[model samples]
Target chain A: MDGTLGEAGEFGLIAELVKIFEGSVDGDEHVLVGPGDDAAVLRIKHGHVVVSTDLMVEGRHFRRDWASASDVGHRAAAQNLSDINAMGGTARHLTIGLAAPADLPVEWALDFARGFAEECKSVGATVVGGDITRADEIVIAVTVIGQCTQSPVLRSGAEAGDVLALVGRQGWAAGGLAVLGRGFRSPRALVEAYRRPEPPYAAGRQAAEAGATSLIDVSDGLLAEARHLAEASGVAIDVRRGAFEIPEPLTAVGAALGADPMQFILGGGDDHALLATFPDVASVPTGWQVVGEVLEGSGVTVDGLAYDGPTGWTHF
Target chain B: MDGTLGEAGEFGLIAELVKIFEGSVDGDEHVLVGPGDDAAVLRIKHGHVVVSTDLMVEGRHFRRDWASASDVGHRAAAQNLSDINAMGGTARHLTIGLAAPADLPVEWALDFARGFAEECKSVGATVVGGDITRADEIVIAVTVIGQCTQSPVLRSGAEAGDVLALVGRQGWAAGGLAVLGRGFRSPRALVEAYRRPEPPYAAGRQAAEAGATSLIDVSDGLLAEARHLAEASGVAIDVRRGAFEIPEPLTAVGAALGADPMQFILGGGDDHALLATFPDVASVPTGWQVVGEVLEGSGVTVDGLAYDGPTGWTHF
Candidate 1:
């Protein structure tokens, strides 16, 4: 049981992974048939289901030395779950497809599952089933199934005169990544942000209830996400620099690195914050901060001017 | 569009991939929102939903030199779609997670998507959405969403009195793989089998409609899958060798390679065949061959004796 996955074999490793989620699966009323079947059967009371998938390759997404197995797992879950949240739906189930080198330790996988299970449990979700295979590098692909309690929100629904609001931290993860890149871990908050993002899970539904016109998750920096909303909705967005109250940690890290903290807020991503356009400021839910406004045009701007900063995360 | 993925960039490549599935998505009645959104919104008319995920890794599960991009794509979709079939559900939606080196040609990705789309179209399913990332090697993870018209058929429902049956070709892919492994490609059919498996997609629903006691897809050879069914159902299965009328192609390949054709029939896999247990031989659906029976015991046997040959494919 303590040996490498190569020794455990695929079936043996799957048994261990299944054992880790046994309690979660058994307790979930929605799951009619869990792991060990050809597929999982789940009762979906909602008429519509929101689905999304995210793939994280070992070195591209996280370095083992920089992030623990548990951190990687939580990060993967957070991103996928955030996609469901972006749709104004509650995350209900997850199916993971994992590929790792045969020499990987069995315990690493189990610990990863523990982290993933804890995250899902926190949001009233569970891992119903998954597949494991051998690969040269570690790759994790998670697909989240969610149910919409109301009409699903879309990025193209924004209209002119809508107020742009944000829920959850922005640029904290980017700041964290910057700090880690500079070889300084003392600013633990930033480093932790880079390790695992904490997306506002409930804010999505709250925004829907509050009559949000358009919605998206800020996996890319605020500017890039604002651009997405603007392009999709056929409207222009204008962000006011003074509207943001920069977090102290980001300020300190920016001072230390001789970089403007505003750049981090404007251009950094991986925070998984909810960005939505409401009919007006009053329609923005409590705990949501208004950072911009929608106008009758296209593209994103900062203080009526185009932002020349780096545009969030890009894979290629 | 004619350049490498690195040249196209993430958004550009995604635009291309989304274009490939545009027609499929537009024609689907179940799709509420398609790609370019944070997540796809799908209407699930069935009371319960069936979900499954599969991962394919380069070199391990496939090789670019051996299989074309389209072949790999078809293989990925086929395996995941078959999982839904095994649950006695109709596959309705798919979410793909693809990771490949940045320098890979964008045309390959487009070709892959085209193959995936064609396969899904054959069964009236569509690619709802997907994610693309950069990795050291190509890794594909596909998750399928399906709808069941009736109660799901689980692998644990087999009884001692049930008759075991199989639909779809078994061991044909295995024979193809063997032929390809030996640096010989004379038998075009066997090589084609390895390139892409043709699963009996309708037989799962047929078996379910005819009242199957238990059901499973033979991704692992028949013997391995039989063991899984037996162990899950707490019943033993007895396979009759004489029941299988070995195909002429397999027989010819076996003769040329000096291997027993029965070995492929019994131990070969990747055929995506549906194996089910029925209350009696009379309940077996058309096109399904009754090859064995469930017995009051544990494990599986061939001709009333333990099968000593290779059990089947092992991932790790």
Candidate 2:
């Protein structure tokens, strides 16, 4: 246990770390099965199950210098949970897979677990089980499970006459990343947005209840995700330029960096905002804004014309 | 679609690959929820579930030079399924988290999926869901779910009078590795053993049915895993030297390498063998051989004497 994870050995380290997360989640009747076996089992109970996964790697998705271990844990879990929300589901449980170098401090790993547990608690989910191994660098892979009491909304249900709406902030994370990359100190608001994305979780369930047809999380830029919905639904989506809402911190950071505020708002990723298309002029739910409308044909248009901007982050 | 997985981009690659395994598993009543959402949902009618996870990384657990993409996929699925087998349960489903560079051949990625699906079919399990992401190296993280009609046989239930048994090949994989490492291409049997491990999956359920007190997978060598069971069960285990029904390939390879055959048998890892302790004196089941006995106190002894061979593989 003194040296890196390799020195402590795989089994030894697992035995030691397993003690911390022992008996964390409450055993409910719905939990026909729990941890410490081959695979967990749960009751679906008259609802559809929602599933999504995300992987965060060192130097790729995150850097140890810019984010604490806890920050990484929170962000990783938040992103996957947001995916579940985008599918119109209520978050329930998560299974995490972690790989790190043996030299990583045990405290950091524990802190990472704490961050995950805290986030799960906020969303009424539990860290059900996970796998840990020694690797060259830290990799946090999370798979989240959710439940939908009604029909689960998908990205292929939108029609040409539907209205497009967004639930939550956008572009702040991209602006914050730019500020960090330039080594410029920024306000707490911008930094916080970059570190921990707070997606509109409850709003998703509400939208599903209110009969939203197509939906997806804005992890990539708004235009990119809009295109996904369009292609999947075989309908074109048109955005109103005046309807692009840029948060104040994002605008300030954009100004400081001499970057286009519209680019950040339209092309910036990792916002975890919920975007959906409704069939009629439905009442916009809380934490949501009317952004545009679904149109005939294919592709995405801004103010009736194609607005050429950065599409999104390309993970290659 | 015309390019490799890396070239196709993450979203595009996933969209293409998802089509293959879209309707693979036979819909079971136990699968209260299936794939294509945030998380899969499975029901446990018997009220008992088992869970385990494993991570396979490039250059660590496998090398592309030594293993075809298909072989890697089979090995990954086999290893996780063996964990369920170790718990004396039947594997039901698996969720995969895969990360590979964008430049990887799309055909290779598809082959990996095919291998995984084939293995699941062999064991009456299904690939329920998964996540795909871009990374510098290939990483395969699998989490398996299993179910049992009765209480799971744990590692802490061995009694001093119980008989210790092993149900599978012992040192074939290690001997195969030695042959491969030394560039001795003569031993085809040994090399195949190294590439693909055939664990006694059904024997696990049989052991559970026949009332096994304690059980564990021989993942990190016989002595090392026996030591784990001894520590967990608070009983000492004694391995009889003459009891080993060693295979001919193991002996032949050991003679050629100028290495101790006993070391390969006792200290070798990754054979996916099963070792358990039972109280009854019934005959050994198929695919199993009686190799040792549980004794009073703790630790493991070989041939009624203290063993000091090479300890199992250490992560640190």
Candidate 3:
């Protein structure tokens, strides 16, 4: 009667999981050979396949008490999907590797799969394959496969004199994280934002069509990612602090906590906003806002000065 | 001067680790974009891309005390590569997801990376990209991308009257595991085999070239994999127990341990040998040994009798 891994056993639990994931496939035949096989065969739909993977661990990536198992699934999916989006590609298929304690409830796994599958489907992709096993703690890794609509964008494509821009959500997740870290849970919107920041899923393709040269997701704050773009492209980027204009929910939270909203805008990551550079600001599409400009130098400068703040997040 | 991850830091260690992985790429341009990017772009060259991922936890999948860090890397790569081999495809690129303790020595990671990269190169592939981070316990997941030369050989392809043969080494690794588990390490060959079983890397293509109807690697023991093939193909497999011919070191070790070598031959999984079905016995390839026959039924029987022994292995 115990609906845990110990009761279902490895193969039995996998059987149940296989049925759950099978229901979520796109049915568009992007996956030639689905799960329950030695390996999955993916049909290459576009010019090329864009693949990326990210791993989440308990205590390090997520606190189980702070978020539900479903939220953990969402967080894992968001990380990988955002990477594909950063590449200017449409996600097509995904394979997940999940290892959890034997005592983990089967119902929890089912919910996690649903949330994970929901995220993939939202991006117009399918959860083609995955592996679920037993471990000491929860270890979830999702590898996303995407199809490039045109030339896949790279981080090294930015040019000197290009107008650096921003698209989609920003800063709210970091504010939400700060609130949650300080043990406050009343602000449901901010709490939810930290759990799963809505990424601009289709904006990567939009930017690609708009002829944007360089692009990256704000997984590592604006300043840090700007530095990455600049360093990778071998050019400098100068940000006009006046452009960020700390948006809604975050502003209220910042005021309540007596924290600088500018610091959040400058250093808050996990918003998954598309930070890109275009040859001309006029061609940078509708959703994007110009924030900085590329130059023939190195590193990043905020308003012509090195804005000394914490750069971003790291694993170590 | 502390050699731990806390002292080395994530980016600083990644900077060192990048050089280790970068040296393993296939020089002939299969990798369009290497590590340090959000995602890796691999040039597709075949019918389709074959992908499989496996997650190994510290105590469940391996023992740190038994296998060195380099051996852990080798074991991880071999498991993934053999999966592609099982599908009759040539491996091209790999993206790794690793989460280790913060106090883990930087030297340990470097050695692990070298072994991982070496195994990748051995299979004519490259480590395209990877993510490394901190976790309570080390978790390693490798997703291997392969290009199929022809219609992939699937587990469902075996038909009645097909000759089930095995190519490459077998039974040794499982026997090795048992001996190692028993806390005796004198039998160096068996101990080494358990640590890093050299899979028949080239025989997968050879079997495909010889027109294999069905194929699978003996990762979950021969009988267990035989059952997998039979169940997937909707047929029965009658394994001939008389044929395995108990090889030298295994027989000696079996005698020493008061164990039957046949059990290891029948159910040992980690050998990574290719167990496959062919249309004609004569066409089972030069290196292959015929040990079973496919028939019109379900499940697997050893010499016309149901196998009462342990089927294979599972973490749970």
Candidate 4:
């Protein structure tokens, strides 16, 4: 049990991982056929099925030294589950495809499955099936299936004169990555944010129910997503710099690094905050901060002018 | 237009790949929302949803020099789609997550997507949504969403008095792999089988309708899958070696390499043949070759005795 994957073999490693996920499926009537088969079967009992996929590479998306297997698993589940939420759906099932080096510890794979199952359980979802393979570097691919109770929210539904709103944290992950870049992990909150982001999952459904015009997850910073929303909706978005009241953790991190916290808010990625546009300020849901406005033009601007800073990430 | 992924940027590469999938989604009404969104929405109009996932790495699952990008794509699609077919389901949608190095040619990625889409299109399925990331090596993960038209066939349903039947080729891929390993690739069919398996996709539904008691896709050779079905159902399978009429291609390859073609049929992997059991020999569907019988015992045997050879593949 304490040996590497090579020692345990593929089937042995999979048996260990399945034991972790099988515990999360108790009392779930929707699962017609669970793991240990060629495929998993589930009943979709709503309007439509919402599906999305994401990949997390070992060195590019995460680091073994910076994040544990559990942390990587949590982040992987969060990112894909947030996509379903972005579409105003409830996540029901997840299938993971993991490829790792043969020398990787069996404990790492088991802990990853535990973390993934725990995250799925938080939202009434289960890991139904997956494939494991050998590779030079670790790569985790997650596909999420969700059911929509209402019409899905789209990125192209925004209109001019709509109010722009934000929910959850945006700059924390950026700040944590910055801290990590400096080889300092003292700021526990910031470092944790970078390791495992907690997306505001319920906010997406709430936004859809509140008649939000457009919805998007703030994965690629606020300003970059605003630009995407603007282009997709064929309108412009203007952000007010005074809208953000920097959190204490970010402020402390900024002071320690002698860097402006606003840059992180405007350019950092992986926070998974919910960015939405509403018909008016009154239509914006409670706990959702009004940060900007939809306008007659193109592209995103700050206070009616362009704010010159980094916008987002490009994997290539 | 003809540059590496690094030159195209992530968005540019995604845009290029999206165009390939977009062509495959035309006139598919089940797709409420397709690619270019956070998630794709699909209408599931059947008994239940069947889902499966698979991962293919560059050096392990495939070789860039041995197989083209399109071949890899076809192989990835075939493996997952066959999983759905194994459950007597019709595939509806596919979501692919691809991670590759920045130096990878954009053409390679596009070709991969094209091949995947083409394979899916053959089964009336379309690519929905996916995430692309940068990694040190190429890793392709595919998840398929399918709908069951009837009750799904499970591996644990085979009875002791059932008759075993096999559909599709089992040893062609193994023969091709042996040829490739020895630096010989004259037999086009075998090499093609190794690069992209053609599973008898329609035979699964036919078997289910004909009252198949147990079903499995022979991904890891005939003996390996037979052993799996036997273990899952708590029954024993006895394969008659004389039942196999070794194909001419395999015979030629086996003769040239001074190896037994029977070994390929018994121990090869990646052919993706459909194996099922019926209550009696009379219930076996047309075109399915009866190869064995289920007995009241445990484990799989050849000629009622243990066959000493490679059973199947292990990733580790």
Candidate 5:
């Protein structure tokens, strides 16, 4: 059973793997229809739904040598959940579509599912339904469904004079990736951050409640996401260089790779950090640190000047 | 612009393609969240949700030389909706994921979207959300969400002495495939059936209302689906040979290929015909022809004899 999955027929493997999650999340009356059906149905009450989708392909997104099947599962779920959190919503349900070679091991697939379930538990969501098919390579496409009891915090509402804030560690994942690629052993914390991101989930809801106007997750790096906010709000974002702080693990990884720590802090992605624009400092949440300010212009500037460095990750 | 899809970038193509369905459906209040989100949310008042997913890969599922992008789109949406109909539900929403080369043209992607929108209109469903990614080859995965006002007619409730009924044409799509593969020119109807299947949608809902105890779509051929029903219900299904009728177009295609029409009727898949088991003849809906009866054992028999033809389509 721990052998390759491609040997087992696609349908048989799915039937067996589905049994593991049976009765996992019982007693949720809101789930009118659960897994085992074509789709799962959830009852939504007086809330706006927030949805996001991401596709991760083998070689393109993850390397089997660097990450285990469980790592892939955790990262997939975390990325989608982080998107929902960025919009000031709590993730509630997820549906996945997986395509893999015919001869992969069943245990690998199950491990992936376990990782997904564990992450869902952390975020208060459930893996409701999924599809599995045989392909030449592996592909994991996850769609997350979330809901907000209040209005969703959009990326277009940032105003001039708003103070910018950040929650959670930044650039640690990127630094870890560099270390892994360079075959250098980084600090344990840095490697862990790259393997499984821990986003500022609760801080998102808190920021929204605290009257944060616009927000986004730092999955595509700080400069890229800040650019998104600025473009969406038709404003400029100015980062105070001295105000930016790098966690020690990131600095250690940068040192190992002989890379500039500032590059990781400004352009490293997959950190899942929350970046928001608030009207005043008093409106910032507890876990959030002031990093910059929103101004009435286009483009992002570091210390009133352009700090040329890597912008972010490009999917292509 | 109706060319290969890899020519345009993913985001630019999506922004253009989504405009095609801009007001296609009138007064669609059930859609709480539509496209542009991670997942689409639908408002279901008094219905059980039915869901199904299908993955179509290039070469394995379709040949670019044989089918246009629009044809692939229509086929993908049609097959998914047909699955919901088999479960006695009305198709409502669909989430699509498309993986293709980065250089694919934008026009082709938009045409594909238009084709999908056309089929969704036929079944009263909408393309709510989807993911786009770059891959070496083309892969189209569709997940359809459906709803039923009554209890879903499952495939496990058939009892002995129940009549077996079918509501749509069989063997047409399979016959078309054979003809296309053999390079034999055929009538337009046969080719069209293979390109875009039109399943008997309303008849499925009617069968459920008429008290269908067990139901399944003939996606894996008549005999194969009958076997599924028998296995799930712990009973035997006997099909009357004389009652299994073939349309003229299918017969012509079979004649051109010098293939037995019975083979197509018994083993052909993708027609998406609804097959149901009812307690009595009176329970069969109009337009549904009685084709067989349920017996005390497991497995399927044709004309009081076991069918030794092809078993049906296997994914791996």
Candidate 6:
């Protein structure tokens, strides 16, 4: 059989993909119906179901020349998983919708599905259902469903006196994108971070358990995410710039290319770190630092004032 | 206020779309944390959650000249909802992902959102969360989460002695496509069917309640779907050609074009009717007609013989 999707045909190609997805379904009684069905059925432990969806376009979200098929798959899964975590929920099932040109290798699609399954496994989730079709370019659309034991941490829950905190590496992915764009593959770690980010998934639940008022995943840059929390919570966020000792990778790459690391830190996005607001500074979890304070106002500020650097990224 | 997405900018355009989506959320207490949050939380009425996802690409699933943006949106939602119905579930929430050229008109995007919301509303569902990004062309991806109290109806459950039944129209959309290609718009019903299919959503629950052993939605032609049920159930489906009194709209259009309505009935895809197998002929629901008998063999047949007609569409 030809390794590419076109030679294998749609039905044959789908059979291979479904076999891979089925391996992740571990007889967990929660999955009443799994892959190869019209739709997937899962037992919802809680009364509430948390849902979120994201799309990754070929040229827009990733570059085939730069990222491997697996990398693209893992990135898509990780980002959606992060969204579920930000809601303070334990992720359950992922339904991924994929579209690629008929000529794409069956091996490529298989590897992509494998990567997606691996990422879901990392967060104790599984691929329950999906749709595959042909398109001019590859499109990965992921929808994640989750259940929460505690009340979901909402962006609108932050109060005026709450302390805003940060968890995990912030600007590593943005910096990695810069290095990859410059065609320098020397810094393997930064490039890897850009390809597959390791978000602190458990920290989100920890924040909620510790009485955090609001939570968000830093997917669209730090400043942009802060603005989201502020706008949703009706409180201004004031970040203490000195508190963030820029990660070593961002600093090293920025200095090597004569580029300012602050741009990546403040404006560049795609690093799935946890940014949360807690009612008390003492209650903030370990490995997370107080980066700012929530104030009664409209927008975000840096260093106790409104310092307007680049606010953030726009996909267009 | 430039009308196009590019002139409006990515963030600005998303704000407009979000405003439209927010109108659908409607302060429903079920939506714990709606649109602005990292993920939306919806109260699940049943113990199980059913998920299905579908993608519509610009040139593949639809053509701009053939379908309006609203029609495209409705078509996308209807197709996904049919998958949920096949599982005997009540549609609950939808999370959509849309990508379009930055230069596309904002009003077009808004119209698309409105149509999507309207479709969700038709089935007592709501739009929960979604992502908007820029691409070379318009792409709509929808994930619907539903709840089912009855056991999920799997195509693999049919027995050899079972009877196959179908509900709702077939071949109307396929015939409509043929007519529209030849530029005949007088038959308004066929044209509209092509644009937006009205699947028999409630009939799925009825089938399940009446003890349907196997189920599927005819998104791909009748012969193709019958083959699917046969393969999954390991029983040959001998469809009775005489049983399906070809819908009136397909008959009207097929005559005008001198095309065999049977070809559209057996091979033309995209009608999205519910097809199920019942243990007894008396168990079939009201609007559904018994179309075939489950036989002790493999693959599909027409009146106890082999069918070599078009096996149906392969997306790739």
Q: In model 6, where do residues sit more than 4 Å from their true spots? A: none
Each model's C-alpha lDDT?
0.91, 0.77, 0.85, 0.91, 0.78, 0.86
For model 1 chain B, the run of ten residues with the poorest summed lDDT: B185-194
| Candidate 1: regions farther than 4 A off | none
User: Clashing residue pairs, candidate 1?
Assistant: A176-A190
Please, what are the lDDT tens digits per residue for candidate 1 over residues A39-121?
99999976589999999988888888888899888888999999999989999999888899999999899888888888888
TM-score for every candidate vs. truth? 0.98, 0.91, 0.96, 0.99, 0.91, 0.97
Per-residue error at A46 for model 2, in Å?
5.7
TM-score of 3: 0.96
Which ranges of candidate 3 are over 4 A from the true structure?
none
Positional deviation of residue A240's Cα in model 1 after best superposition, in angstroms: 1.6
Q: Residue A106 CA error for candidate 2 (Å)?
A: 3.0
Each model's DockQ?
A: 0.88, 0.45, 0.72, 0.90, 0.38, 0.81
Give Cα distance to truth, residue B120, candidate 6, Å.
Answer: 1.3
lDDT of 4 by residue, B93-114 (tens): 9999999999999999999999
Kindly list the per-residue Cα lDDT of model 2 for residues B90-188, writing each as its tens digit.
987788888888788888888888888777778988877787877777888887777766667778889998998888887887887777778775588
Superposed by TM-score, candidate 2 places the C-alpha of residue B58 at a distance from the truth, in angstroms, of 1.6
A1-316: candidate 4 lDDT, tens digit per residue: 7999999998898888788778877778999888889999999867899999999888778888888889888888998899898887889999999899889999899888888888898889999999899998999999999999899998999999999999998899999988988989858998899898999989999999999999989887789889888988999999988999988998898899998888888788788998999999999998899999999989899889988888887788
Quote the positional error of residue A237 for candidate 2 in Å: 1.9
Candidate scoring better on TM-score of 2 and 4: 4
- Looking at chain B only, the TM-scores across the models are 0.98, 0.94, 0.97, 0.98, 0.94, 0.96
State in Å the error of residue B169, model 2.
2.5
With a 3 Å backbone cut-off (N, CA, C), the pairs that clash in candidate 6 are: A4-A105, A4-A106, A5-A106
Docking class of 4: high
Better of 5 and 6 by lDDT: 6
**Per-residue lDDT of A282 in model 1:** 84
Kindly list the per-residue Cα lDDT of model 1 for residues B256-297, writing each as its tens digit.
999999999899988899999999999999999999999999
DockQ ranking, high to low = 4, 1, 6, 3, 2, 5
After superposition, the stretches of candidate 4 with alpha carbons farther than 4 Å from their true spots are none
